[model samples]
Target chain A: MSRLAAVTGIGQTQYKSARKDVSMAGLVHEAAERAIQDAGIGWDDIDAVIIGKAPDMFEGVLMPELYLADALGACGKPMMRVHTAGSVGGSTAVVAASHVTSGSFDRILTVTFEKQSESNAMWALSIPRPFSMHLNAGAGGHFAPHIREYIRRSGAPAHAGPMVAVKDRKNALKNPLAHLQIPDISLEMVMESPMLWDPVRFLESCPSSDGACALVISNEKLASEGPNKPAWIRGMAMRSETMTCKGRDEVNPLAGSDCAKDVYAQAGIKDPRREVDMAEVYVPFSWYEPMWLENLGFADEGQGWKLTESGETEIGGSIPFNCSGGVLSSNPIGASGMIRFAEAARQVRGTAGEHQVDGAKMAIGHAYGASAQFFAMWAVSSEKP
Target chain B: MRDVAIVNYRQTVPVRDSGPVNELQMLEQVIQGVINDTGVALEDFDFVCSGSCDYLAGAAFAFVEGVEAVGPFPPIKESHVEMDGAWALYEAILKIRTGEADSALVYGFGKSSPGYLRSVMSLQLDPYYLTPLWLDSISAAALQAAQCLNSGTLTEADMAAVVARSRANAKSIAASQLKGDYSVAELLAEPTMVSPLRKHDCAPISDGASAMIVASPEKAKEWCSQPVMVRGIDHRIESSMPTLRDLTRSESTSIAGKAAGIAGVDVQFAELHAPFSHQEILLQRALELDDKVDLNPSGGALAANVMMAAGLDRIGHAASMIQAGRYTCGVAHATSGACLQQNLVAVLEAAQ
Candidate 1:
């Protein structure tokens, strides 16, 4: 008995290594103001605000929504802060959608941001623990071994990783807000980059960035009377598990598969490869593209690399991926997932100026975090459900 | 919102300093205790949501380890919030209202004794404008108390009376960290911890965890002996800047109270999350609770404040009163941010 919800406005701040020009409040306000303006409404129109971000250590500000309440126009309104590691951005949108679907609120503002320059994410992430050893490694170091394992099991060609890097960095040229823009990116240049983590080259890993993403969600009534073409939300889901339980599959997590299955069922999608026009998936490391493709049921186990190697994942291909350059090019950590979700909505609305996939009727957005144990996904369509 | 009820709730004794016990171990005790109290197996829950601050642990993604305590081997659907656990309950309630989940397990944990809590709380302020000045939590509350005192809205005796009553009521509750019987004059005579505020006027820095199981109406009837129904719940936040807000009043609490239908109805008892004694007065006035209502029956947070978990503890204590046949209906309030910048109000009732 859930009501219908739609995405009427999407806004994002320019991705950068350090947003030194503005404070944390200013950075989020930059995006939130744009979202409210794009929704063809004033700050008074929003009934609630839901914010998501990585750990509080990212900005040394605990429960940032408290400090950001006025900046995002959430004063005297129900404001929520979500944290699910990296997948929080996507989960935040799902939570916001639930408010509208449950007949709780009409228009809601959902925002996510991470100011990595405030403090060292690596130090915050790898602090010494009471019962555990000091890993002293960032996400790249932790994820590299999984990439090695994926290569060992799938026997995918070495070129698979480089190809993804070249495609996404080249795609960044079309996105003005993307952090990394390599107009002539090629496979050789990516392969020649220094090896930071064993299987993850320097160019294959995502950079530490400071940015924010904001979206305006509305119930059916307001969406129908909106000025812009709304991207109707068909379904959304979130799932999680222990980070490293016994007999856990890190490369292809069951939580991710379950999340995808639940969302597809709610969207009435039987065949994702044929039904989903394009996808914007979280891929901080280049190798994650194929790994997630298989885990998300787009390709069979041990065969997802073939999709990337055959040029089928590029724009105008059978099923395009990362058409807006995705997380590899512009990753603000906390906002990375929502950026993917926002890009999918932009595609369905035919508003993605340079990166829009032609005739994109439906699209999928996906994000994973916490050693691949937490996941969130959503589906949006041009036509109302 | 759909009809949801709190079937069971459990919490650890708030300790001034929880030695050697990590958050996971403390959470395991309550997670298992609440499930056992409700007679609901782990698999019976359709979703799990938790609240905790990583800054309290001084590590990033510290909550990720807590999922292990929930036994997420089968990969349960779940989410987490950075606010108090009361907000986690709000999300679970919405999930049931959406017909997406039937029942949920909500929990919150924090260990604030490891750090200088007064300074650690400063991190909740605006980073560029307020945090850099190192305005400790006590100083901020003192500012609000000064305003309330200057306006004659509150008196030193009123604040001491709150402390004396909290200490007396907390003695019967085993989970309370500080419990004693003292006169208002005796408390007022103590040396000031922060000018305009005495040591008894502030909550102790406690460490503990709390867990609650909420279910839809049908499920609640099948699972529990006495189910406490959640009538209406609403939460609102005010401007963060102290300069932009009226420090003497809680505008967010007043708004949330009305939205949760706290008007007209006879609210028999209350559990208010007031870490500072003066805040208790502001909340009482804001929610319009008169002398007839039994306030802070379990000592509220003044006896034991466990940071993130104390707010949810207030909700559970209020429902417990109704379930125990002491009151027919009650109001519970949880506040976050400095000087009660954010507030949540829930009205709980038991079937007559």
Candidate 2:
């Protein structure tokens, strides 16, 4: 009953520790303008705009979309703001797709960003609430325990985490816009890095960067006629659970699993390992690469680390993952998820210049947040369903 | 478009402060109330969405705590907006129209009592320009009222009449925080709190939460004997810079009203979310509504404005009136940003 939708354009600002060259509106405008240009459409063609960010506290602005309406050319148009924590970028894209798929609008421009330079994400995230103990130092401290639990349950080798860090960082060399471009990144270098969180080393964690990502989505008719090849959206889904609940499995969250199942079902994918040509998943920490591989059904419950250790996740391997360097290389918190989703679209559209997976016909994009209780995933293919 | 209707709606009484009852507890009560009233289990909802502001709670990821209200043990499909609950309902309508969901639970909450509500709202301005000025919300509205009065569009008595009518209507709404009968002459005699605006003209800072259950036509019939159909809904936004806009007129409201097909329907009664009484007058003229159309029958925002939830409350109140057979068709309006820069309009009608 739903109309088909596809991604006709994608744009991203260069990831950096601080985008001092541009203000918040200017940063977002850079990406939105690029996306609109890539889509070969004018501002008048867009029916609506949807923007997303991690939290207002990150930049000390409440409902920033209001102020940003002019910059994004959303004046006199339907504008919306979505917030689902770190997964907001992906969720924002899904909502934009809904604008087309629901037959409400023909074209929608979706944008997400985070200027962490404005404030400290660690302090914003770890603010002490009344009556609640503030034992967690930050996101790293909170997620480090879960990563350790995954190691204890999976029996992953000590080198597994370091290997992932090196692989992702090495991939960053091919991505010009990646925040971190360490040409000499190696397994030994990652292992020798300071141990920030016990099982997570300094090199294993993501960076706090300021950046923005944008996408232009349209219905089938306009998409087919667009100047560029469209990445047809096969399926999209979002799921969430309480942050902490009785018998919650933080390491292998059910919400992540259920989200993958729902998207795969809609995409008609029976075996994701075989059907999915590539993936760009949220791996803020190196350990999450394997944790999500298992949670997303790419490997058996306890065998996800084996896939990584086998070197099968490399670009020339069976299934290339995070070929764009992923969140580990460039994390703009709010835009991290959409960066994954955009990378997937690039692969399927044969537009990923240096990191393109050979003949990638189908790909998956995934992101999670809030103690791993929220999950958002989408499947895109070169061929229309 | 799918025939989505409001089957059940619930709200907690607006109060000056919730005290020990935190945001989660206030939202939980409303969510539970809607579920119990509609006899629909929590898991029955195909999707759940909520709207709230992090600044109101003065913390990051404050909405995460609201998830506990649904008891999401099984992990449900959900999304959230930083806008108002009316926008959450818009997302639900899109989901249902796409066949991704047949039923959705939408809610919004905010507690403005803990902080200086007026000063807290200034944070919504342009960070590089207006935010540095710390121009609070009240002063912003007062500026708009001055423009309206200077233009000779409306007098102080006209604004007072909106307050007088709102107070009289609040006598019927149990959730209303402020209610009293007063003539326009009596209201005009009161001291002006913000130059051109009186204290009664501004919406009371109240803490509350509201929830609504919307479903497809089939599910609506199965859930409730009386359902108010959402005829049409649309929202629009103008420039954020106050200097770029005409504060005397709500252009966005007029655009959204036309897009929502208000001209095609004979709206009998209406509920409008205008934090300030002068805004109600601007919105009425923007929507092109005549005096025949009843406005703010539930006292509107001036009586009990619950920040993020007040917009949805307008739609909920209008739907409730339709269900009660007070009128067959009505229009519900919600506004955001200073001087009604962003606006949403929804037309609700009883089942024909």
Candidate 3:
């Protein structure tokens, strides 16, 4: 049997367009130090370090973990770097938990970050390759067609996208570390925003930010001994498929659904909407909120937009989603997924300060990447399984 | 720990430049080869993992395209690492040990021929300090080699001997890129590319891919008649700053070798991934392998270094040697970063 693992501590840097105050190593070290402190442990307590980032081109550093090893206190310890496109953050956490669950290490310091300000993410992602079309501008252009398809299929109102944008930006008010904290954000404001891609406005898109997220994962024994409440990892799963396969569902990817099903099975949840108290799903575009809702089995197919229109995904709603502002508000690209995972852990730990979902016992974190072909999700709970 | 063994391994022949052939095509050949040789369907594996660097490919999410070769139409449990394929194998081991998967398929591919590999590797250095200085990989190794030579730890003759042995060994390996009989004296006579390091001292920039399937004991028995058991595996990293680390020795290798239980096993041979010739001598001492142990029978990385895939190739060669009844037990070592800042070691043994 696999050993139990839990998140004992979490840390996150303030998301911003640029962090001129710190270097790359300093940026990662800040999060790691805070996580180590949050766990009430010293550098010596960590058994290994696992880090993840989107691409080396983003920071112009190939395998930055090799250089940041000293900053993260990974010297003389096993260090691993994980990269699975945009889902890298969540995958890094899953890999770190494996270290504990595999009965290999006791305490692992896992971190994910993105310094998009260091390089233009759009340019880095849109590099022209041989024999490949260059028409798709950036993520916005690549995903805009999928959003249009979702609208065309679901017959959801055009207001559905604006509603999600407003709710998440408003939710950002409660998150001090959120990058874009427009205190007066509203649906009207989002609707009036300039259309960067047809059917997707500037306000509905995620920001390019510099930030890092860290988590201190420990085996069951060490978890119980930690100073803070542990968010027990009930289950975790990752799934991937080819980016462009004939007859693939881009709007509601099977990988996301399968990943959700696998995680829920491990967590022993028959009904996710009733069992999961809250979720922090990856929604770089506001429309993805509803798309992922159905993919995660929280809503019926073609009816996920109805949940947004009904305000059921708000902070006080039955199944609160993105209560920590989510990727829409504070996207550090690579760290966005881990932020979702860490936010879920924070809610279960009752440490989400202002955005805490009251009495949240079980929560799930989700992230997808690479044309929605990669999916990673994990279920966490205050109660141990 | 659960018993796991490498059931099958396949790799493309290393080439200086695989012109017109992309990474996906190279990977497909090896992945298909492994499947055909083992008679195992793709869906039979419980997990799939890969290792590659976007920097080497000069595009973001390059590994994503490599995934197409796997034809994951039904979606599959998969993950990836930015490290060497040896680390991918490490993750696969963890997955099996965690009881999450009974078997896994791991692969690594890199097309280093597309770019100026020497300068491209500088991007892996500290961006603020080292990269700005443009300290390419060969110069970095030369710095380490200079330190080794200055310390009298090993003479230039020792490095030449390693190059000679590697070249002679590559003659029998079909995938090897550099192969020809050459005496140590002839190699030493060649002009140095970088001071204290001859042109032959460096591993060539080769493009290639490798794939391997590992399974639990029960599955191993059902699949292969002589599965090479993976007795122990461990990897560790040291300080990344070249100045902070001892350039003359591979401390990380020593630590990982000890952790992998290398000392307890009567290792009959060893496959060491030493990109620089002098590194081979340093690693031999660090691993404490005497002359009795056969070293780099597949020419190691000196003959054909495929960047991310070379490390995994070492493990594959080690396991293959045991499977061929060439040796009952062996150790495989892989290194990464400058001056061997990180290292992985594994012990493979044939069924007793």
Candidate 4:
């Protein structure tokens, strides 16, 4: 209906449990600068800045974008701050894309970061609120019951958790900026790891990371004048619902399905299993790989496990997913969604070194937050929409 | 090119009392007033975005109730900004430009009556460097006022002039709080709230909300008799590090002004969000408006500084002037953080 916008550049930081080396501002700047460089442009070339993050509490700063303006080279330019729970990164990218597609700005710098190590995520998310019982159990703990339900419904074996943990840790080896690197990791190590949430072992869960993700989004005009081939944003969609609602299916969120449907319709994608080349779905917990696979309509209801069980989610498998280690190997919370989007772009560009999906022309990037009710996803491709 | 316009505008009056009603009640009425004024159903708006601070509500996701206020059954497509609703307007505009939605609803709310407004604003400063010093917001504005005075840009008399103009301007505005004419000499005689900034020099603490609905050119005509088209909209930011930025002038405002085509704007009236008297002069200079412009026609934030929503309210007032056939063209401004680190400037006009 309007001029298409595309991702012309992408960059990310080496996610880690603790980035003792750099401050939060410095961590974000590193990613932004690299993204600018990748786009073969300077800060002056950008028209606006749109930054997103999980929460202000994650870094103990209130609307940190105010302070980060100068650091982000946003001085005297329209800058915006977005927050939509954990899916903020994906939402942030879409906001930037809107500016481009709307013909408001020719070039925009979109970034998201979370230095979760600055404070404990479990404590940060569990900050007591009025009229609400403090469950104190982290998001994984909140989802553990749902995960159990999925396990019972699918009748998948318990060891399937370790299978994904080992596969993704191995995928992390390909991403130079990945946070966790268990070079000697094994399925045994994953199986033996302490079960923090039953069926969700400590090691099986994503590591808290201090990192950032950034992208330089531009419209067809800028893309046509780009230094590299553009990742055309075929379609983007975000749908959010109450975290506590009657008939809220934590196991299979309707929002996630609806969001996927909206984006697929725009992208003109009919059969994701056949039309889409690869995927980068948010998987903070290992089981989400299968859960989202089903929710996204890549498989029949409850048959997501079969796709993963048959190795279809691996790098070379049909409809390969999470080729950049996914969120299981790195969880920066705010930046995690953008990382998934960036990894999906990498595969399409044929730039993914260690985990390249051959001839990847189209792919999907997805993220969800807050009891899995909030969902943000995008369909991207090397070919222009 | 497609044009976007503000089809409707509404705000809750800022005063010293809200009695016993909670956020839910306040939002319910404000949202109803706005939706009815716009003549649009909740589902008619293809996009919805808002702005508010969680800390001000003394809880997390305080704006979540605001979404409920919209009665978003079937899940209306929406997003949020942690900044002022003025910025939310900017995001909503982006949606229009992208062709994702033909219309949008942008709103914001804040309640500062429960806490010390100045003391709570210190949270917006740098946690490591500024927070430990406990530099509240009003004092910071006062410091900038003192700097303006020292720079010989204006005197206490000039500061009093701004206060007099703002208060006098509010007299014609409906439900305006601080409206009346007083001489600059009289204002100087008033007691000071903070050094260099008298009680009259600073805006009153207010708790309220504002909502605006915007539509595409085709949809705009269907909704309103006269929609104030968005001619130009821009925002800019300076470093939050107070020590690194110039306190006397808003560098961010000047940048935003230029991007918003301020040079070409033939102004009639403006609704400026000047929390303090001196900052108004600073913003005017940054915007480079000569004697041709009628600035702050509604008394501005100086009359009732309601934090997040006040900025958007300034915008609403300016557009109302144009929509009511009172102004041929106009401008509105909104600011955030200490020392006016972030600034938004919007230009409104009657379509040719």
lDDT by residue (A1-385, candidate 2, tens digit) is 2789999999999999999999999999999999999999998999999999998999999999999999999999999999999899889988889999999999999999999999999989887777554636778998999999999999999999888899899888999999999999999899999999898999999999999999999999999999999999999999998777688899999999999999999999999999999999999999998999999999999889998999888898787789999999999999999999999999999999998889999999999988899999999999998
Using all chains and alpha carbons, the TM-scores for the candidates as numbered come to 0.99, 0.99, 0.99, 0.95
- Residue B251 of model 2 has an lDDT of 92
Q: Report the C-alpha lDDT of model 1 over B1-352, residue by residue, as the tens digit.
A: 6799998888999898889998989999999999988777999999899999998988889888878889797889899999899999999999988888989999999999899999999989988889999998999999899899999999999999999899999998889988899998899889998888888889999999999999998898889878898889999999989999999999999999999988856899999999999999999999989899889999999999998899999999888878888898999999999999999999999954
- lDDT at position B136, candidate 1: 89
Please give, for residues B1-352, the per-residue lDDT of candidate 2 as tens digits: 7778999998999999999888888998999999999887999999999999988988898888888888898899999999899999999999999998999999999998888999999999999999999999999999999999999989999999999999999999999999999999999999999989999999999999999999998999999999899999999999999999999999999999999999999989889999999999999999999989999999999999998999999999999988988899999998888889899999999987
DockQ of candidate model 3: 0.85
Q: Write the per-residue lDDT of candidate 3 for residues B32-54, one digit (tens) a residue.
A: 99999999899999999999999
Q: Give the TM-score of chain B in candidate 1.
A: 0.99
Error of 4 at B85 (Å): 0.6
Q: How far is each candidate from the true structure, as Cα RMSD in Å?
A: 1.0, 0.9, 0.8, 2.2
Rank ordering of all candidates by DockQ, starting from the highest: 1, 3, 2, 4
